[model samples]
Target: MIELVACDMAGTTIDEHGDVYVALARCVEEIGVETTPEAVQEWMGADKVEAITALIQAGGGAASPGIVAAAFTRFKELLVEFYAANPPVALDGVEEAFRTLRGQGVKVALTTGFSRDVAEHLLASLGWSVAAPGVEAGDPGKVLDAVVCSDEVPAGRPAPHMIHRAMERTGVQDVRAVIAAGDTVNDLAAANNAGVVAVGVLTGKLDREALAAHPHHHILDGVKDIPALLSFPN
Candidate 1:
């Protein structure tokens, strides 16, 4: 049985209308590095700094720390404004699924590639707070057991630090007891690196072909099917 589920935010849980890639592409372009949305998509589950670095490298520029930092700062500003202007919507059945998992003594944590500020902003818009099991605040429908972000760790997805941090914060020691779900290859790679179940969901930018090209344990139509995947008899 899965004791904890570490889910990705933008595509897997919250629907942000592809604003993340847009902001990333815009920021990189500002630095004279023209990039396509598909280029940014390749690093969807990575840290913004890492993503910016990749963009710089891809566009034949030196991905210095200074350049990555500058690009990322601008990306944060743009992303914050974009989300504020157009608040995101939760995926269908996400909240219900959280409640169901929590009710079954299973911990549910929302992990994201975005930094804490952006993550908190998105959570606040959804009326959710980042807290542990008993000290939750805000809309009960939107509460999660924990929230882990890329900035909190040394590295993000495909490195497994975020997943390890989520497990640490949630007090789950065994990797076999966790399941990581998201809409990109990076998410699956992270889970695979962490030695946990890697689940792919189709609600994000990548289609089945893209996701299938990566390593994963299972594929679901959407996160709503997670409960069934876990054999939760409700």
Candidate 2:
């Protein structure tokens, strides 16, 4: 039985409509690194600072600490402002899936590659936030068990820290009893690295072919199928 479900934000739970990539391209361009939405999609689950550094380096530019910091700060400012003006919407079936999982005694945690401030802005915009672990009573239909951000972990996706932090915070003792689902390869990689069931959903930027290239236990049409996956005997 899965005790917890670790989900990714943006493409996974929240529908950004390519805003993150747009902001990413604009931010890196300020530092002389020209990139495209397709390029930014490759770093979907990575920390923004690391992604910016890599993009700059790929463009034959030095990723100076100062430059990275400045670009990251600019990206955050742009993203927050963009979201404020055009708030993101939750993907179809997300709220229903979360409620279903909680009804079955599964903790639902939302993890993101974005920094804490950005994550908070997203949560606030959606009128959702991380509930304290072990809270006995709350609107299980609406509250999340935890929210893990890249800034809170030593590293982001493909490193397992975010998943580990979510598990730690939600009191999920066994990796076998966890399910990590997202719409990117990095999300699948991170779940594999963390030794949990890696589920790929086709609700985001990545296509079936791209997600199939990664290690995963199952690939679903969307996260709405997750609750069904949990209902099976393990």
Candidate 3:
């Protein structure tokens, strides 16, 4: 029996594309860097700093400490504004699945590549508050047994360390006791490394072809299949 469920926020739980694109593009313009949307898409599951580094490199711009800081600061400001302008939408049937999982005495945890601030802010914005009763919406922490942020990890995706950390803290020694759900190759890689069941959802920047290249046990059009995937048998 699966005792816990862990999920990636951006590109997985959070609707991928659109607002993020505009925010990054506007930030690029404001920071005086000419960039193309396709370049940004390529760096989709990476950390903010890594993305900035990649963006600068691809755009033929020099990566300086000062320039990097300026670019990230501008990106955060615009990204926050974009989130405020449009509400975060959780994927289909996710809330119901979470509720049912918790009811079955299963522990819920979240692991994401997003910084602590971004993760908390996004969850709060979307009402994923996970209180004792469970994540009713954006505030998911209150209900989840634990949360592992990228800042707390040695490395980002494609690394099992983050998932291992979450499992360690949650006291899940057996990989079979946990289910890792994500939307990117990095996500699948991390899950596979941690020896957990990997489930992929096509709610992110990657298309079916990209996702199929990885070792995902279940592939779905969206997160709507989470409940069924868990076999809650409703």
Candidate 4:
């Protein structure tokens, strides 16, 4: 039995309309770095600051601390404006899925590449509350058991820290009883690194083909399909 399901936020649970990527691209371009869709997509599920730094270097710009910090600040500003104009919404059936999983005694947590501020803002906009790290458990009445952000961990996706941190936050020790699901390659890589069941969803930037190229156990249409895939009892 799966004790916990660690999910990604932006594309997996919330439909932000890909504005995050647009904001990232704009920030990098405003820094005078040439970036392509492919370049931006490659860092989709990564820490925003890290993504900006890499994008700067990859685009042949000097990734100085000041430059990266400035770009990140701009990205945050752009994202806030974008979200204010077009509020985010939970993906269809995701809340129901969360309820079902929690109702069945499974702890559902959200893990994201976003920093704490951005993650909190997104969750607040959706009116979702999550338990902070180091808490033994979360309130069952809340939408999520815990939320682990990239900033909370030493490193983000492509590293297993975030997933491991999620497990720690929820007090789940056995990797065998955990599932990590997301919509990008880094999500899968983190899951794989943590030695859990890595499930990929097509609700984000990557397509079925792109996700298939990475290591994953199950590829589903969206987060809504996780309960069905898990074969949870009705």
Candidate 5:
């Protein structure tokens, strides 16, 4: 039985309209380093600072710590402004899926490449509250059991720390009983690295072909399909 479900935020669970990527692209461009959409897509589920540094290096600019910091700051500002004008909303049936999974005794967690502040901001905008590990046992009324941010872990997606942290937080000991779902290659990679079932969702920028190139056990249309795919009790 699946005891835990670790899902990604932006493209996987929330409909942010790809504004995060736009902000990332603009931040890199403002630093006088031209970046392609493909280049930006490569770091979709990575740490923002790391992504900015890589983008700078890929574009032949010096990825000095100071430069990376400035770019990251700008990226945050851009995202905040964009979200203020165009608030993010939960993807169709995601909350229902969360409730369904939690109702069936499965823990639902949101693991993101976003820093804690950005992650919290996004959650607040959507009026979602997740219990913090080591803080609370998780409110039964909350949509999520826990939320693991990239910055809280040693590394972001493609590294598996966040997923591991989620498992640790949720007190799930068996990797086989955990399912990690997301919309990017990094998400699949992270899940694979963590030795859990990797599920790819089509709600993000990547299409079926792109996600198929990665190591994933299942690729669904969206998060809402997860409970059905898992054969959870209805």
Candidate 6:
């Protein structure tokens, strides 16, 4: 039986695009690097620095402390620009889905590629913060058993570090009893690397065929289907 759940934010739990790539492009542009949507799409589920690094490497460029700092400055600038004009929206049924999982006695945890500050802000505003928002009286306590930030990991998704960190925090050793959910190919890859079941939701950038083709265990339309996922015998 599954006792722990490790879910990913951005695309898996919410829309992946929401200012991420926009910020990326802006940062790359500021650094005089030309980036493409396809390239941005490749780094969708890793830490911000890793994405920037990938951008640098793909173009046969090198990054030093100075370049890294400059890119981050521009990235933050773009993020502020995005939020100043347009806040992001969580996917439909995301809140309810988290609530339902908490009610089912599942120990929930979160893994995300965004920085701790950005992830916390997004979660706080969405009420899907690290755990559920309202956890008093009729409310549930923070829904998550733990949280693993990409920055906290050595490499980030597609590396299995984040998932392993969450699993370690939750003390879940049996991969079969764990369901790792996300919305990107890298997320799926991370889950697979950890030897846990990969559950892909379509709300992220990658669609069903693409996600499924990558060896994910299950594919769903959105986070709302999580309850159904828990019902299966393991």
lDDT tens digits, residues 12-74, model 2?
A: 888977688888878899878777666788888788888898888877778899999999999
Candidate 5 Cα misplacement greater than 4 A, ranges: 131-141
Supply candidate 5's per-residue lDDT for 26: 99
* Clashes (N, CA, C under 3 Å) per candidate: 0, 0, 17, 0, 0, 2
Query: On residues 24-43, what C-alpha lDDT tens digit does candidate 4 reach at each position?
Result: 99999997999999998889
Instruction: Candidate 3: count the clashes.
Output: 17
TM per candidate comes to: 0.94, 0.94, 0.84, 0.94, 0.95, 0.89
Worst lDDT run of 10 residues, candidate 6, spans 132-141
Tens digit of per-residue lDDT, candidate 5, span 1-234:
899999999999999989999999999999899999999999998888888988999999999989999999999999999999999999998988887888778888999989999999999888888755443324544788889998898888799899999999899999999999999999999999999999999999999999999789999999999989978644
Best-to-worst order by lDDT is 5, 4, 1, 2, 6, 3
Query: Which tens-of-lDDT digit does each residue in 1-234 have in candidate 1?
Result: 788999999999999988898999999999888898778888998888888898899999889888888888999899888887887999998887777777777788988989998888888888876555554324585458889989999998889988888899888999999999999989999999999999999999888888988889898888888887888754
Off by over 4 Å in 6: 130-141, 232-234
Give each model's whole-structure lDDT: 0.86, 0.85, 0.74, 0.89, 0.91, 0.76
RMSD of 5: 2.3
All-Cα superposition RMSD per candidate:
1.9, 2.3, 3.1, 2.5, 2.3, 3.1
Best prediction by lDDT: 5
Residue 30's lDDT in candidate 2: 86
Candidate 3 Cα misplacement greater than 4 A, ranges: 132-143
Report the C-alpha displacement of residue 160, candidate 4, in angstroms: 0.5
Better of 1 and 3 by lDDT: 1
Residue 104, model 4: lDDT of 77
Candidate 6 per-residue lDDT over residues 69-118, each given as its tens digit: 68977786777667657766667876666667666666678898877877
Off by over 4 Å in 4: 131-141
